[model samples]
Target: MKVSVWDTYVSREDGKQMHFDILVPSDLKDENTIFNFGKSYLKSKPFATKGLTSKECRFCHVEQASESIEEAIRSKGYYIIEMENCN
Candidate 1:
């Protein structure tokens, strides 16, 4: 049950800076977890997402995400640790 919190940043539709921490198990490497994270994150941050489509969510766009970020996420395990909005 080990966990790690990775700090990251994202820009809101209005250009506001949002900081966040993604918590994941130490051995995560599954795409389903990423999709689930996107689903859950959107529900928790509707204002930030505003009018974006599912494909527009950061978690859903892992392929285009920074390599380091994706690597870190995959290296961990397939379950979502926690998505903390640090706005």
Candidate 2:
């Protein structure tokens, strides 16, 4: 199994910043499980839940992010079967 981490920054109304760290497991099959876990983790954090919603497993533009995530995984000794955004 491989794991990928994503860091997303969203702006808040008070000029502060909110960050969401999303962890995606390569072998994860159930989207609902991932979403639920992410939601629970973010909700338990100290920050107010006003900015970006909880970290999401499905990204609209995941190509570039997936490439970066895959590289990071490879560095950690995971065997990558396929990768995108090589450039």
Candidate 3:
């Protein structure tokens, strides 16, 4: 199994920006696939929750700004798969 990564930035509620990556399989290359993968990846994270906010925790920014970042990743086509598969 191979993994694809998309690098991007997210803005906190305080307007602080942070960088993170959206990871998926290289086989899932389409925008819809990447978008759906982003949603699933976010929902599966421990930090994800209802009414998530970026008030004090920067990590919460990820949950709040996931859609936009995912769209940006899809639009930019900035994704890569590592040679080695962790799977």
Candidate 4:
């Protein structure tokens, strides 16, 4: 997968802005697998698994991951939204 940093944008809820990186995978199948793996991994985290006590950014990351999956499906392409919440 090839990753590229894109422009950043401020979220609606807060004044804080974040940089976004887009990951473009050569193969669509790989992208699908990666997305699923990411979701499973994040959802398995203690914070996410516990309840609503998780940080807001954690929830945002999950939403972003879901968006990436949809983008891949709609365009028949691969992409990821890398934010500070991501390692």
Candidate 5:
């Protein structure tokens, strides 16, 4: 499946950065939905900052989804690929 990748960076309360990619189907063009997905992901993190907006997250590109990513998107409407400082 093809997915749109939204590159995201959020600041942690401890003054670090969290970098991740939010992947949704390529046809999904709603920024609000994408940002909400990001917000949901933040809620799962201990370092979650209270802000997830267009400034922190932007549409990066569209690419083929890996099997795991496709499965995740199929189940939850989106998938997340953590890039940095996510632990």
Candidate 6:
């Protein structure tokens, strides 16, 4: 599936930066919904994260999704690819 990749850099409560990608269908353009998806991902993490806003997350690119990512988006409406300081 074609996906929109949102490059996100959020400040962790521990004073470190967290980088990740918020992936959703390219057609999904609602910023609020995307931010909510990002919030949901943060909730799944053990550490607390600063609020996710447009300043912290922006459209990075669009690309073809992998099989796993496609399946994830099919079920959850969005998927996250954690890049740094996730643990």
Number of the top candidate by lDDT? 6
Per-residue accuracy of model 3 over 6-79 as CA lDDT, tens digit each: 55343434444445455544555565555544445435444433322333112111123345445655665433
* lDDT by residue (tens digit), candidate 6, 1-87: 899999999999999999999999999999999999999999998888888999999999999999999999999999999899988
- Considering lDDT, where higher is better, how would the candidates rank from best to worst? 6, 5, 1, 2, 3, 4
**lDDT of the structure predicted as candidate 4:** 0.37
Model 5 lDDT tens row, 7-56: 99999888888999999999999999999999999999876584899999
* lDDT of candidate 2 over 1-87, digit per residue (tens): 345444445444455655454555645446565555555554555555443434423432222236666665456422222122111
Clashing pairs in 6: none
TM-score: which is higher, 5 or 6? Answer: 6
Question: Backbone clashes in each candidate structure, one number apiece?
Answer: 5, 0, 0, 0, 0, 0
lDDT of 2 at 59: 39
lDDT of 1 at 20: 48
User: What C-alpha lDDT, on a 0 to 100 scale, does residue 11 get in candidate 5?
Assistant: 92
What's the lDDT for residue 67 in model 3? Answer: 54
Which residue pairs in model 1 clash with each other? 27-76, 27-77, 28-76, 28-77, 29-77
Q: Which stretches of candidate 6 lie over 4 Å from their true place?
A: none
Q: lDDT value for candidate 2?
A: 0.45
Error of 1 at 84 (Å): 9.6
Better of 3 and 5 by lDDT: 5
TM-score comparison, 2 vs 6, better candidate: 6
Candidate lDDT scores, in order, read 0.46, 0.45, 0.41, 0.37, 0.93, 0.94
Per-candidate TM-score against the hidden true structure: 0.44, 0.40, 0.39, 0.26, 0.96, 0.96
Q: Write the per-residue lDDT of candidate 4 for residues 1-87, one digit (tens) a residue.
A: 233222233232233333343334333334334444344434543332221111222212222335556567357443545665332
Error of 6 at 6 (Å): 0.2
Top-TM-score structure, candidate number: 6
lDDT of 5: 0.93
Candidate 4 matches the true fold with a TM-score of 0.26
Model 5: runs farther than 4 Å from truth? none
